[model samples]
Target: MNDPQFNPETDLNFDPDGVPTEPAPAPEPTPPLPEAPHPVATGRVNTGRFEPVRQLYQRICSEVSKVYVGQEELVLSTLVALFSGGHVLIESVPGLGKTLFVRTLGKTLGTKFGRIQFTADLMPSDITGAPIFNMKTQEFTFRPGPVFTQILLADEINRSPAKTHAALLEIMQERRVTVERTTHQLEPPFLVMATQNPIESEGTYNLPEAQLDRFMFKVMVEYPTAMEEVRVLKEHSGQVAVEQRLEDEVATVTGPEQIMKAIQLCSQVLVADELFDYINNIVRQTRSWPQFHIGASPRAGIALVQGARTLAAFNGRDYAIPDDVGEIVLPALRHRVVLTAEAEVEGHQVDEALRNMIRTVEVPRM
Candidate 1:
């Protein structure tokens, strides 16, 4: 019987005189290493797929920082919402650079920017535009409004009447506006960055729950740190005109195509099967918790997953992990959940509720 484990080359039987050995057999070939998939191409500028995404992200941060000064969390969270294909609601007092930040982002991406100073009398037509009869042509022509742009800064959005707010509902969700029974599609990569003053409730209409739900994150832009304030002052201490020129001066880091492609890439990020259950578990618990009058909706769960994937990609990973889900749960769910009167009386906060839920839920071992 032949020896199965025997190798003619390695297992040679040498004669008493070593010189009497037969020639050695050929050696076995070494197996090749498996190759990884190439990163997805981003756009016309093929600066190596994922590398440009990360580089552009960092470049935007650097360029925006030149004028916006500090507020890294505010900037990053906004990017997360953008890349996740969701809108953002910013709560801050006037002069916190909320409008400037949105404009800077728009300029940085080379996308069209529009700003609507939402007031008590700001009409729906003022935002979504209307059809006007062309006397010469004898036909009604559809006129596009600022909302038709890629990035919209709805300044003091809550100050507008509920009717005006309602105008945004369809477009925010469906990305299309209807006027005179005709629907028009908005340009791609449309994001609404609405601002509100949390300290003042007078003359401000509370955002409808549906409107609030449309936002993926409700970021509170606070006063800058002492150092940041100093830097901001120094950077803008130049001519007021120069200060206003920052957005215009910003070189385009990317275009609408790349921004849209990056968003698509983020959507395609891998979310393990177990993570879906984990996300659902967290969202489901919000409903049954004793302190809550309203829990996060199904849409909130989807937002959490999407936001997590964006974060994972921002960190240069194709696959999402538990930490990715955890990092965004609070911001993504904070505005979505409402506290009961009893809980509010007890000083229970939505963030606290989320923290407790995080501690209670069993994080699946990846």
Candidate 2:
């Protein structure tokens, strides 16, 4: 009623006593968007990219042969487990190059490697990091252990007590260690290659079935052939001579980033739905079978698939075939399944059961 025509912009004014109000500052100018990450370009030819992975494998084998003489199968299986992002359990007698193979592989790949010589009195905190008091910050800081590396060689893993073995299960499964109410994530491409001496069981504690199941492959390294043994002797004639020989011959074949890229490519390998169903059927049969006291866990199924993918890549293929699944059957499932008392008494091996299961399962036609 005071003003019939309202013109707020022009008529409204601040009195001397009235509160002064400033016009809202112009909205800040919007910033430019960040550029997208560069995309890797594919070539015109689809000449299998897995060729690089195969080359890397061959390089690893060659490097390992520099230190280890025989057990080509063991080396290949260990590489397959690594490609699958899984750990391995090498069960063999002493002086079988199990430790050397792991160490050499670490050298060839140019990855951070650590070895933990397990003893009967080893503690859990010895493997997983432990918290320590810090005087500077007046707080406890986690001191990482040997497990925080690209490749961890658990030498004589069975010599450790059950509790020590159990400590690694969580690290292998979750890829993290919890200390002082804080969890530390392990670096990518983390792998644990654990070796156990089969002949010396006097003081060693048998790895619990639960701990055994964490390993993707249980490789049995046997004595080399006469020819391979000859090669070993020729290569290691004398400590000084062998040291001189490897001075300039060895070189890093691949980096951690390339290895990770190859692993990601393995995930892209095609697996038909029928093949998946076949795998499921085989896993289900293990559960229903009467010969087994405990069937393979879900982890076994995953291991089977991952192992097959790596095998396919090893064969320079971009797709998984039935033969791939059949090839890795024993190593992936042997440690996971437990036999019944009768099966054990009858000397029925898990490998034999796995072979039978593979034969019973139908192969999906491409």
Candidate 3:
């Protein structure tokens, strides 16, 4: 009533409650830009924090190359199995540098290396050690054999009797040895690289399926190419030169601690759901496929995935692709499955049948 023209609408700077009386602003519209893809969704996982993995991978290959000539695939496969925390089986004739390759790997990794020459007369006690009475202390002492080392090369493993071969099954799977009712644990980074002669079967015993399943990979070492042969001949002209070269040229690039670190890093590699489906399809086909009498076990699928992760790390990728699985599946399952009599009569090989399975499986769209 102070001013007749003072209308509430025009003088509405203050409300009855003394709160500001401005009209609410319009809501901002969200931008309509396209959504960004998730790291895993895009198929390329991030390696932002794992620089050491790629660095160590390159360093190891470079160091192993100095003394060990070409066989890049062999070296890579072995390294994959190593970082995967699994054992390797190398099959070839005598004197193809199988022993040298293993020895060089041991030296390169700077681990405690031991060699056991498997023979028909070899006993489990010889490999896992036996308890002996200590004359000085008048007490029983447990002495560890070659199995106590970080890397054990079981040379000519097939020459050993079944009983001796069975000794490794427990230790390989459990990473521990039980002796005289006492269990001893193997140190981390333990690996066994066993070699066998493929040409000779007269005295060799067939590795049982249980023992075969324990191996992560059964690599078939073939004859060197003409160029590679020439290089080997030039490098190993004399035994003394070879030994000196291995000692001087092949430097220790790393140790067990670094290896364990790499193994841990490998476990972090990203694998998408689609890739898992692909692995499942491939493994499932093995069971139903007519070519195989005994198909790959579930463990084989897991091994493939683990090895693929390591391979992905080696290639400096944070995510595993279908190619990585394809590259490692053969080695992972070659020893795990057996061909049917019909397939064998038709001259089908395990690797060939596995390849066919892969080709038949549908690859997920990236």
Query: TM-score of every model?
Result: 0.84, 0.82, 0.86
**Where in model 2 is the C-alpha error above 4 Å?**
1-47, 134-139, 241-247
Model 1 per-residue lDDT at 9: 29
Clashing pairs in 2: none
- Rank the models by TM-score, top first: 3, 1, 2
lDDT of the structure predicted as candidate 3: 0.78
Clashing pairs in 3: none
Best by lDDT: 3
Per-residue lDDT tens digits of candidate 2, residues 77-192? 78888899998998888877665666677777878888999998999999897989999999988899989998988999989888898889889999998887789999979988
- Candidate 3, 170-213: lDDT as tens digits: 89999999998999999989888888887889988999998998
- Find the 10 residues in a row with the least total lDDT in model 2: 35-44
What are the Cα lDDT values of the candidates? 0.77, 0.74, 0.78
| lDDT against true structure, model 2 | 0.74
Q: Number of clashes in every candidate structure? A: 0, 0, 0
lDDT of 1 by residue, 1-366 (tens): 112232322323334332214433332343321221233432122122233344557667866776677777789878898888889898888988877788788777778888999999899999999999999999999999889998888999989999999999998999999999999999888888898998898899999999999999888788999998988888777776643676366666667766776777667667878889999999999999888889999999999899987876665456667788877787788898899999899988778877987799999766
Kindly report which residue stretches of model 3 are placed more than 4 angstroms away from their true locations once superposed.
Answer: 1-45, 239-243
lDDT of 1: 0.77
Following a full C-alpha superposition, what root-mean-square deviation does model 2 have from the true structure? 18.7
Top candidate by TM-score: 3
